[model samples]
Target: MKRLAAYILPVVLLACACAQQPQVSEQTTTDTSTTTPATASAAPSAYDANLAFGPDKVVELKQPESNKVIIKLMFKNGSMSDPKGKEGLTYTTAQMITESGTKDMTVSQIKDKIFPWAAGYGANVDKEVTTFTFAVHQDFLNDFYPIVRGLMLNPAFAEEDFKRVKSNQQNFVDEVIRASSDEEYSKKALEDLLFRGTNYQHMVEGKTTSVQNITLEDVKNHWRNMFTRNNLMIGIAGNYSADFLNKLKADMVQLSDAKPNIPMAGQPNKPNGVQVEIIQKDNALGSAIFTGAPMPVTRSADEFAALMVANSYLGEHRKSYGKLYDKIRTTRSMNYGDYSYIEWYDQGGSFQLPNPGVPRTANYFALWIRPVQIGEGLKQQYAELKDINVGHAHFALRLAMREVDNLIQNGMTQQDFELTRKFLRSYIKLYIQTQEKQLGFLMDSRFYGRQNYIEELDKLLANLTVQDVNNAVKKYWQTENMYITIVTDDSEAEPLKQALLNNTPSPMSYSNLVKEGLPKEVLAEDDQIANYKLNVKDVKIVDSKNTFK
Candidate 1:
């Protein structure tokens, strides 16, 4: 009941806020002495225009919308198209196009043109696709559209601009990501561990060494080959006229129809047991832990529906009522939060909903444990515990594993299943709240070859039961064979590695003597969790500076 209330209370408030005015059945007459009554309004505009110019370009135009306009250009080729040594080439090229000068305008001149219209253009390069998004108000569409068109049609890859973008890319890998951040480091490390030998091994940003190797020739060559006419899909949603849509389509069709023969991602070999990669950093505050196994399921599969329900019960992205949240954060107060995912969920630690345009051909089930502060608080108790990340990391790992083991072993109850499904059905309504968001999701659905995911999920949840969810869990979810990546201090690597290999217990110990209101069963459960068996196949610590090199 407590868990259910945690989820339901907020939903009730949202429902009240969304209450609509009473509906009228027919037109009613009003007296002419005072005022005339207003006539009925027209039906809402169709959400999907579903117009296609050719085999290459498909457009989804939504109506009954606001003054804002969002245009997304999705190229079928992404980082996977990068040549052997040039990992970050695609992302660098995208940055150069968006941030660099155009053929007619300088970089600063391009910014000056768009800034007056309160519009901006950006690009995101994922594993399988590179999406270029253009956002502007309807009033400023004329000014913004031409600038973006210039970027797409005739980009001036100036040598000066390429040098600057490449330098920034290198700094991001060196200063911001690999050097300063544990959470960010763990994220990339997880991917590298999962797809070590494959093309999907590196982040879209590429590695530090790869960024250094990328040249002006590489960027220009990649852009010409990958960003061709046949590899594009345009998504526009706003208050645009039919004439405007036609013009945009015609302008987009001028490029040559050439598609790159990119290789699809093959399935990574399953982990033998719990493999661990400990990145040793001296100045780290807490351990950033991430673990997962590759999943064959996607939205197109029937198993995906059941997996959604089971994953929500285990850990729904930002929700507080997930089973992992209840077990780790609520019960023992281990970390800031604990969450699980059934797909390649980026920004799972902070964001409420999934971001669009990151549709993946290959997906994985992952768990993120935010930095733990155990060593900082318990240093005086244990002299060897110099790094707080190490201690908190050990406990957080055990707690996370215990919750997953229980869920996979015991499955979910009818009450648990019903509450999650009910919550999920209503929560999904919040996904496509705006015209731009709707357009983004629509493009993603088209990419996955699905018909309106939001509507389909509603129907699936309405009919799904506990048995259905558990059966999916048994088929897809697992604990024994998985990949683990943790970023922590060099001093604590051997201790942490030894702890995992030895199957040591990480029991929860209170600082104070008082044990007044705590439940004994919960405490006993933590004991078993501390000793939970992990078949750790390999464990090694590498220097932080050396990683992503």
Candidate 2:
């Protein structure tokens, strides 16, 4: 259930590129307790009992054959714990801890020492948790422990570091996302709409204004309040001595024992109909569309396994075998890719697999339609459709939703169910191919009250019947109400908005040269997809410049 395929590109490239290693093994410890079946087995019962440090603390996955050691420290608090006005405090504070130097060593000095060992560390903040991850070859564990401990226990919190981290965060929100990656911008916009008026509304980095308002003192204070022994969960993987583990535990005792009083994020506001937020940006080449609805289920739910299979059948992330991908991209060549998710998938564009350490108390079902060509690009690519300025955004959205509605109404056929389930049974095993990813997933299992997510899910998937998957779909899946976000060219915004509102017939356009290869069935289905009705309850168009402000 928990998988960390890769970090964000900027962070991975700039901060932790040296730590990258080829995954040598896919071995993970399986808990015997989870193998048993019971009526009340929805929630995993033996996660704490199997941990090395008992109930509230450490989880270890010892890979004796591995040469690298990976440590992940998760704090129970994150952006949701940010004070009312200081929205980016938790994220900025985490950045300050990982990116800045310790009190005894300068940033350059620390890097110079770590460069030889090929070790690297970084922090990731999400809605409910902030994690600091470290990786080093076991040969350097003795020497690297001090620097890692210093980063956690004694940050310099210097004015330069604070200013630099804050400026970077602000730029990420205000410029980088808006200008460089419209896919991410659309996803952020969708989350904001889904979680509007709630603690989960803002991005983990916060808005541009909120980040600017944060002072250095705000970071320090947030660290003191949220980063405590009571809130920490330690996970380590790879070869390490028992003595080293004890020393690590003793070192962590220096942290304050203050109990974290962070509140859980409330349920996101559900949409009344197809509520849409259109972000109008200048000179965009394509439209990045995201649609989602509150699912009210997490990994701990009984329906999780069933929904997983259904979501995989509809649109698996980054995979080409999904129905949506086959219909929209393979058959019609509408976009780069189309996918769906049952839980939080961070940095979907960068990571081919699900990233771990981003567990959430509240979850939603999401669809990611990677950018569709628009304007001149659309006209040039498919020159057969005359006077077609607005690209295939409308048709794509309609086709995607129509598939979901079809699944809900008719359910997956036995053959489709068998094939998808068989694929998932093998596909999930690839999630824990590395020691870092394996440790991250085991730690995440503890968060969701599970012993081992991959193990539990694999077993759950094996026993699930076609009826079970279809039943779960009928219970949870719906196309009537959703929060939709579209990032498109400024010139096409009004037309796209009008097209959605009017349920316009967006016929597929293909060049004459390419049209000769299409099947008769594909052409027949095009008519139905063009006129698919979308109950657009409301639409708001905002300039991209105004977003995250």
lDDT per prediction? 0.72, 0.81
lDDT measured at residue 87 in model 1 versus the true structure, 0 to 100: 88
Kindly list the per-residue Cα lDDT of model 1 for residues 1-549, writing each as its tens digit: 000100111221112111232111111222132222121132111121112244225555545245666687888887887787888888888888876767998778877666656666677788888888777777888877888778887788999988888877888777677765577679889888898888888878888888889999888888877886557787776667766765676566554345577888745558989889998887677788999898888887767888898888878876789888887778767666778888777555445888777888888898988777535546756554543433767777877887777888898999888888888898877776655556667777777887577778788888887888898888887888999999987656777888888877766554443234568897777678777777787887888888777
Structural similarity to truth (TM-score) of each candidate = 0.87, 0.90
> What is candidate 2's local distance difference test score?
0.81
- Per residue, candidate 2 scores C-alpha lDDT tens digits across 475-526 of 8889899999999998889988988888879887777766789998888898
Off by over 4 Å in 1: 1-52, 374-377, 380-390, 513-517
Model 2: which residue pairs collide? 3-354, 3-355, 3-356, 4-355, 4-356
Q: For this target, which candidate reaches the highest lDDT against the unseen true structure?
A: 2
Q: In candidate 1, which residue pairs get closer than 3 Å at backbone N, Cα or C atoms, i.e. clash? A: 375-388
Model 1 scores a TM of 0.87
